[model samples]
Target: MRHTEREPDYIIKNDNALINLENSVKSLCKHVMLRQENEHLKDLVIDRNKYETILGNSTPVMKVLRLIQKVEKSNIMVLVTGQSGTGKELVAKSIHYNSPRARKPFVTVNMGAIPEDLIESELFGHEKGAFTDARDRRIGKFEEANEGTIFLDEIGEMDLMLQTKLLRVLQEKEVTRIGSNKSIKLDVRVIAATNKNLAQEVKEGKFREDLFYRLQGFLIHLPPLFERGDDVVLLSKSFLTDFCKENRMGNITLSKEAVKFLMDYKWPGNVRELKAVIERAAIMSENLTIQPEDLIFANG
Candidate 1:
């Protein structure tokens, strides 16, 4: 007679053990995710501190620093408005380097530098044979900046037609190559900088009103050097120290008269002009201190 196969009661017990194992694995995964998030927060804090050191502690600069701290964690579009040389690109860098996507690429495109004919191809890329000169497939700024950030400098200079395309990118998060009918999806964060007043450009009909609104989700206006009060002197000293260190020269100090002249003259080129002036003074100074005569003004 054939013996009946034994039905093991431990099968039910084994099912319970499997459920416990699954629960334990889920708990471990949750713990790992939480730890990663905490590390990211810690990195963000460190980045904020680094930016604080770069941007001085003057009231206006401090205000901007605080704003950077608030916005760096989010992926919102930012519009930085200031005169040329006011460190708009620096501000963009600070944001990107502090965000969750800090490790990703930070692509910068100078809207004013590209020719009108090639601007579209430069931004949205092209197929290998898209244009007459097309020898190889080219990736666009948006694609290069996938899952990262794209800084559009001199955004006001973008043509009206291109503005529409950019607006579509911001809305749809996708781009189509010039010769291809297919659209490539992107996860790019846009940060635009402009020396021109986009509001004025919009009113003047030179800029698209819709695009202006889209880009200006959060606006940061960098004050000119003259308006920054004591920041001029602070920045001058900082630049001097940097120049000295870079050249392997002894420490250089700015003379009282040199400080007076720097404070008195308006910096038309903003911080960039100030940096250039200080660098020149550092190089030209025969003594350890920068004298008034050593400080040359471009306007003069």
Candidate 2:
């Protein structure tokens, strides 16, 4: 959770700690954590540095920040929806790092990347000899995140069978590892993110309606970078400055023409893409000044 997202290609890591602190503090007082140590948790999360890395003045961004403040304190399931590279995981990390569970393990599992047959074991662990490859007992992500938070990314890709098991686990607040009858209790906060339109997926029978509704205890939708107006300029300068300082390069500035060029293009890849382009431009430019000609989109 050092920077903007799970995507490390472009996220500057310096300010994310502050951002997490700021965003996480706003919500700690809003909800009573379902724990005996609510007061301790509050003390653990709140800090002096309040401003987090989320930089935007646009109404849409402001609304998202306000919602983060409202939802950060509770243990309710959170669903973050947006296009890929829109910083869904960033939002998820902001909540976890700024919450009472900041010191606990923050385990992340990418549902879409795991093979369907193995994901269940990856999430809930497996007893020794549970499967041919289960040579030893394994601790799953959920168990590892006990008393902390588990971020399930690309949840829309989880198959129906696993979805059923996951729903049961969420409902019971416990997990039974494969080949084991004993269920292990957990106190993990759940945060899930997806780029797919889950409503549409539920309609198509690809996603479970019950699970969809269950994940919607609090929903946050991240707008694509293109829709955030001048945040692009703010972000551009920030990234420019950080990249220069990080590399020990002399001060670098984006020419006015380069800024105009950034504002004009529709960033289909969102914040992640913008950061990559700027970092690349910073390196590819000949001098401290970055002009329009220095800009280059990686895939475009």
Clashing pairs in 2: 19-52, 19-53
| Candidate 2 lDDT score relative to the true structure | 0.87
RMSD per model, one decimal: 7.9, 17.3
Q: What TM-score does candidate 2 get on C-alpha atoms? A: 0.82
TM-score of each: 0.82, 0.82
Q: What TM-score number comes out for model 1?
A: 0.82
Put down candidate 2 lDDT per residue, 10-63, tens digits, no spaces.
454536866787778766645545453765764455332123467788888999
Q: Per the 3 Å backbone cut-off, how many clashing residue pairs does candidate 2 have?
A: 2
Q: For candidate 1, list the clashing residue pairs, or say none.
A: none
lDDT of 1: 0.89
What is the RMSD, in Å, between candidate 2 and the native fold over all Cα? 17.3
